[model samples]
Target: MPASASASSTTPAAGSTIHLPKTSESEQLLKIRHSMSHVMAMAVQKLFPRAQVTIGPWTETGFYYDFDSPEPFTEADLKAIRKEMIRIINKKLPLERIEVSRAEAEARIRAQNEPYKLEILAGIQEPITLYTLGQEWWDLCAGPHVAHTGELNPQAFELESVAGAYWRGDEHNAQLQRIYGTAWETAEQLAEHKHRREEAKRRDHRRLGTDLDLFSIEDEAGAGLVFWHPRGARMRLLIEDFWRQAHFAAGYELLYTPHVADLALWRTSGHLDFYSESMFGPMAVDERLYQLRPMNCPFHVLTYASRLRSYRELPIRWAELGTVYRYERPGVMHGLMRVRGFTQDDAHVFCLPEQITAEILRILDLTEEILSAFDFRSYEINLSTRPGKSIGEDAVWELATAGLVEALSRKGWAYTIDEGGGAFYGPKIDLKIEDAIGRMWQCSTIQLDFNLPERFQLEYVAADGSRQRPIMIHRAIFGSLERFFGIMTENYAGDFPFWLAPEQVRLLPVTDEVLPFAEQVLSQLSGAGIRASVDHSGDRLGKLIRNGEQMKIPVLAVIGAREAETAAVSLRSRRDGDLGSLPVAALLKAAERANLERGATLELASPGKEHS
Candidate 1:
């Protein structure tokens, strides 16, 4: 299967000198991965003579081939298969591409009795081709492979795992065995790829979410519906608070739109016709069908069209933390990343035609500011133009596409142009953030839409007193709070920044004698707007410290007889090492300042470190 955004970015690893390019970015890697799959299929067939091969495709990171076998493959089988693949590679077998007619292809497949190959052949168009390995083995594939097997590095490829897959991904079809493997041009690249896979597992958000008590998706509540635990909710509040403040400061007004609306409204917006598959089935309320909104744009559009607006208010920016629901397939529910219900940080700007570039530039500036605060400083940008089956006139598409380009240019950000890759309504700019491990997650989009305004019949009174359709620019910074939270969690590996941590400080009482003092310190910290709590577990000092570290608490304060008597507490910081004894007042001040500044760590040596 092709790797999704959950897979890490193409950026090089943190502090690593080695760079591993994805298969898409490197043509040589593509051929290597493709040929590796054929070699693997040959190996499997050689080792398990009855194994039948189906489709094998190169993924971004690796390749996988589906097979029909009477028995499932085991770890021992994989080892033997690897040995056979090495033998095949060492033989310097030539891979010759042979284009054959329909009859000839069917004859070969019939001779092999490969039913899956016959089905695949019936569906594909001519000129049908096959690739032969040496003189003995051949399979159906239109390949651009290396000249010989010797070109593949025997030490640079590995069979990773085996999983069950249905034919054509249909559950009704007969299930097959899929073998996943990764290949690289060099042994070092293969080593790097393996290291990244391990690191990805280590930083998996789903695992960290449970380990940190952040969130859950219980089967009792059905799939894809998140239950944000207390700690996770608090952090979410902090993020939302910051987002609201940023929007207000950027001169945008917040709107609280309805979660469900009349079904006719969606039909008017074209979602009912085009996006019904993703939407939940409508419910009848008061004899009228109502839909759980799958998008916030249509609601915003209705709000814009509620009343006539003057030219002076042309560039109106309205934002919302709107919760929306969509029908995600059963097997696709992946923690917070893909969910049935999610709160989007949605915003729409209705501007004059002349204001598109300026509004887009402003959005770019705000996007950078908000995402940078979360420590995602590196970005990969794409400017997507109109698709082949898109709405809006050619002139309008050109204007919208040019506006996005001008904004990116004015912001001095380099972006790749994705021709005919935009939404049906308009052109857009997509931003992907590179995490600490170099994996990219898509979180931001700015689309200049001409369809929404036209559909909703939205108009503003111009300076010349004529009603004109205001340009609607739909943008989302976080896209969805749930997905962004997952990305951020993995980005930090659940060790959140001091400002964003649910419990920024924890007070550990060294002894029963220090309980009163610890409570006093906790009061002071909480009074100063710091998220602090006493350990209160009555555990030993060592255990308390260990527990605090295990929870990934940013700062831990230990109160003992000596320290309490001196009106100070010993502190340990996760970001910075052990901070020496500091008075309760100083601790409160530093924490409050860190939260106020949205800082990653508490800097005690700064000018405001000491409290009066």
Candidate 2:
């Protein structure tokens, strides 16, 4: 049994002691957030007066105001508008919320030529509200604002950037300009936010991918197709190796499936009609249409149906690191976080109705085990029940839901219940792991899928020898390998743990005299399965150390004339700083031990210690 499956009292309960930053915490933050949006709207209006304001809401970190602008916002315009916003903040006008009737609100909005506000008013319930800023400026808002505009610290809020968003998060609607801004209660909080932003920028996967020669998204091949370079391939191989080991230990059978399948396969999976937009176009293969796979579930389901299963094989766990392709909008194509083509650490379990709880429990155990190996321990679990429009019968849905609840209870893990939040197919448990920087990323999901088995007519021989539909559970620990890599990069801030570090140790020779000794040391470390490299650049020792530190190499072995002669190396660690000198044999042993243990930091033997 995995450590997570073990009963523990430290586990959190749902909605207990979780710190969620809301508008109620700090009045200054709320005011700053509200006023900052108004400033952004004012800036947008000045830049493009025809742009109509729709709505702006305060998020956890910042606020975003949406507008129906004639021109799409550009990077340069963001800077100009930011300057304009600063001027507005300097004015320090008051913000007052005013209530009005439908007719009165309509008349005021009509006079201002704000048609979007009229539309907003129409959607709002009775007792409509509006916020007026010093009489001249007003927006249709139900606001909990600061007493005065002066309460908003101008320096504490910054207009981050602008993007094109749908009018009301609907793709069919017209696109609008979304100005994103971050606000804080005090200057210190603002500074911390800026520091975090800078840290995130520094650890951006795109930058690291280029600098570390990990991967590349080639423009020639079109967007979303990631080309993993040698270094990145090595890391991915290591990750996959560990993942396979863990999965096999957890009693999961690995499967390899094709990248493309016949369109009829998707039609049977019910994805052709509902999920076609996200899928790639079909290609003709000898008068038959074949489509690239956007998901591995259909393929896995087909495999299960390939043979008539037996109740004895109930809770058959199968896993695959299958690569998938999807059609994402051009502008939404972020680095690794959002990609069109990526691999998923997907798994599917086929089990009897009575075996649902045990299978789900096993999945939860595996999810935590796999994630925790990557230094992701804290998780936020959400249990989404059936939606209004769904395929499965009420009894089956109830059975699946109850099984999930029972499994969660047995595991002693707390999860939030998202009522009516499940997919049309079935209920699901989504796990969002908290990263090192206190940011959460949804990486694991366990969904009880009732639609796929029914659509495929999947059946198994029960104890009575009757053919019955087997319940399918779809789960993915690393939701997308690419996205998980991006999150991990940001979480570690590019300073990967010793085991995961691409270049674990860089042997820096003080001079040409020690080059041979450094190479020998490097070779020895490599032979011990350590990722060690010799700096052949022949740069000064200080420069070499600086370069190694800048690249975030976990360990640096400096070979000077005395140390080389004495068969010892001066050690420096990124995490522990300088640690005098140690014999080569001791250093190699420590490196090998860290590699085997998957330790975060390498623990070198004491100085002057020699292994004989």
Candidate 3:
């Protein structure tokens, strides 16, 4: 089993009688959230009449409202607001929508002395609309609200938090207070939401990274730049080693590309013209421009265009863990999850059109195998077909789409067809892996492009003595390695699987008398290719064991006088359980077996496959 995944210890209880429906999947939930925001605004204004409600919108999971208020809100204010909201809910006020002209809406705002509303009325489209909650309040909106406030459950909603926000997200504009809240159809679902939120906080990768001494985002080096510590680097090396081995086994040749490339190369590839917004500003060098690459695809295209190729070498699979940098706005920079500089496990397949189906099938197989290795067995797959406007010929588009569908059907994996969701250049397939917390993160993508080949005029000599453009398929399993590392960190809650643990084993000597034996045992374990270290800090055995547990080491070896005399060591397994003192040879054999098999736990008493 690929590391059985669940939010068991860190999320909502499995038996909780609640179903949190996605906002897109539930119209009622959307309405509830939209109405909840209005209720919160009403509550705030009732308490602070000077507070001006700006915008209140429904989000995927909740709702938020920005208010230009005279005083910042406190936690106590949130509590008071909640009480007032529920009181209004108990009144069962009817919600009514009214359509008016821009002149009338502006007149109403002026009467209410709301300058923000007047400004909003000026910018909105004609056939202006407003929603009224009973006879009390009204605001500009395009609403699909419930008939009455009674439809909302007071117990099912809660004000989450508040923070400062600039009006329209502009720094030059007046800063406003933004209040965030969540609403559901039932209180049970609210409880589940709270549980998940708490769990997410506990498993936050930023916190875990620092606590485990894994990685850091140094203030001096700037935000969004990761500085991997020794322990974190070890795990990254292991991941990369496994990735290379898997790619090689799947017939992918690794490539190394430069971090900066000639700006003309990007222009030739159409990125300079189309993707300049995400790119860093060009630097001038020797009166010419130097561009920091935000993507590796153009470089791969250059390599294919480097030399003439024959038909026999049609399918060339090149993979690279290439690092690229892009400009992320100040507030958007996040720890690993969203970064300015990161490595992408990117690969491109240059194959003949006739070989598209086979190559796609192979890629599907490879994707599943690679993802499953990291314990991601469940995937949400989407096949995006050609859009209204695209680059390739109609016949070629049909052929490429058919190839994708055929490969998916052959692979026997169900997928959702996102009609017209593909890029203008071609069709593609996207895969999102569900983590331990059941949150789906977009990771793998396979796009079949006919434009890059055409733009670069890539060609290969066919048997008929004519040159034909080869199909360009861009794919990435780990879309961004840094993001994936963060996801994996949270997925495992920093308790990495045994095979991937940075510190596999720690040897604890009960006293100074057993130090020599512990060192010998550590050497034996290290010699067997196991990551083992001994505690030499002169701490007591209890402290050593506590430290090892805190570090989440997979195994701990307790070497006492008795064990040292018997040439054995007592083991406590984090994944498995306490194993009685085993002979040095037995311990070594089990450690080697676990390391080789990539098993979840030690092979303790028996030699068969083991599970934690």
Candidate 4:
């Protein structure tokens, strides 16, 4: 039996629930996903005849299909499968949908000797549908596929990779070979997708982290625990400093919370029942259970309830750079992007219902200001409404959703709506910033939660001396500091701006005679608060330049006999080509100004005239 079957057969406890996105509502994404799955299934069957199809579905990125094959797929196999898929597209086969009774579907699946299909048929409801890819192939599916295979451009599709996936995503289910592919509407769209993939690979945080010697995840320390090297730590400190300054400017008071708390606090927040799976198991602390926190909201709430106050203390915006831990399954960890431990730049606001919209708007404005400083200006916003299994009352849900809508409108920003997609606790606004290559990454979220206050019986003294519950707004600008660091590293392609670069200037001496002058210039640069280093290896000028360039040093200053006598230095920059000689004072001033202004490159134009 597949791992998925083993996991699914033993159902959860009675009344247990899981959140999943339904395909019925997102018709466009669903059709693209369903059709892509069929294409993958057909490709796999064509490449490996012994392989029997199981199931495939579309995801946010693209579509993936699973097969129960005796032989594990290799990289070469994926290429051949992609070629076969293109051939199928050239045939322009019609994807005709046929509805059949359960009995008929079972008969056909059994006739084909596909046990997986038979199992799928048993689970499907009435009005069973099978989509036929021309005459040779068909799969059990309820699809809104394209009219014909010709509608899919052979040039617009690509087969990505093969991974080990359980038959139904459960680790215990039968392990199957999953083939992933992406398709778009036009050839240009396909090209753009490929470009984006290449860009993402180029900007992969793992590669940058190693090349730049920024951070690492050690197997000895256990997976998903990040170890920040000296350079990475310095950058993180700079970021933290900036974050603190911004929060103070935005009128937010800071807080510090413990990493472990009593298990009862989690129960009070209702995380014990609904979110225990993702949480670390409790530890025995003097006959009581204590667990490491996976979120900072509960701790912040406890601080709020530590002492009661009047209505004048309505919008208490408190922020923290709290680190939390959660248990993530082994194969799911990816560098700093998804980690088991991370520091969240979390903030919470307690305010009246009437202040919800304005609070959300302030958060939006702050998010934009902070992210834009890192050169991420373009944004893709999403407002998720109430889910079916939400906890808040209908009127409260409506009010919260309206608040988010009003805030978004007031900010004059366009956003997509994910209907019934909010967390069980509240509605939310998720913001994904577009990187240099147009890839979107979710990094910020502002959620209006009504469940927590009610669960904890949180109250503030009203103007009339009545106790009233204050609404809670949870927000995080950089969802995780480590993840944001990785993204920023990739965004600049490891060529950090002058203000953020690990070493802003590297002085290279052409020969032994120039070493003293190089040292003098380095001293001047360092005195001006510039990160400067001297290449004391005494290597050749060419080799020194090559080393500096390879390390992605922003500015390289060269000293020779002529420069030594003239008190000038030859300059070269990564963003700009070679700049001729300049006086030491001029170089220092430019470096200082660039660092202060956070300029991408130093402003060292060509020499105006030769020194007299």
Our tally of clashes for model 2 stands at 0
The candidate scoring highest on TM-score is 1
Error of 4 at 202 (Å): 1.6
Q: How close is candidate 3 to the true structure, as a TM-score?
A: 0.94
N/CA/C clash count, model 3: 0
Q: After superposition, how far is residue 24 of candidate 3 from its true place, in Å?
A: 1.4
Q: Write out the backbone clash pairs for model 4.
A: 2-173, 2-174, 3-172, 3-173, 3-174, 4-173
Report how far residue 221 has shifted in candidate 3, in Å.
0.8
If both were scored by lDDT, which would come out higher, candidate 1 or candidate 4? 1
lDDT of 3 by residue, 68-136 (tens): 998989999999999999999999998898999888898889999999888788789978999999899
Cα displacement (angstroms), candidate 1, residue 33, comes to 0.6
Question: Distance from true position, residue 230, model 1, in Å?
Answer: 0.7
Pick out the ten consecutive residues of candidate 1 with the lowest summed lDDT: 1-10
lDDT of 1: 0.89
Candidate 4 has an lDDT of 0.83
lDDT at position 483, candidate 2: 93
**TM-score of each candidate?**
0.96, 0.88, 0.94, 0.89
Candidate 3 residue 136 Cα shift, in angstroms, is: 1.6
Candidate 2 TM-score over all chains jointly: 0.88
lDDT of 3 at 213: 95
Query: For this target, which candidate reaches the highest lDDT against the unseen true structure?
Result: 1
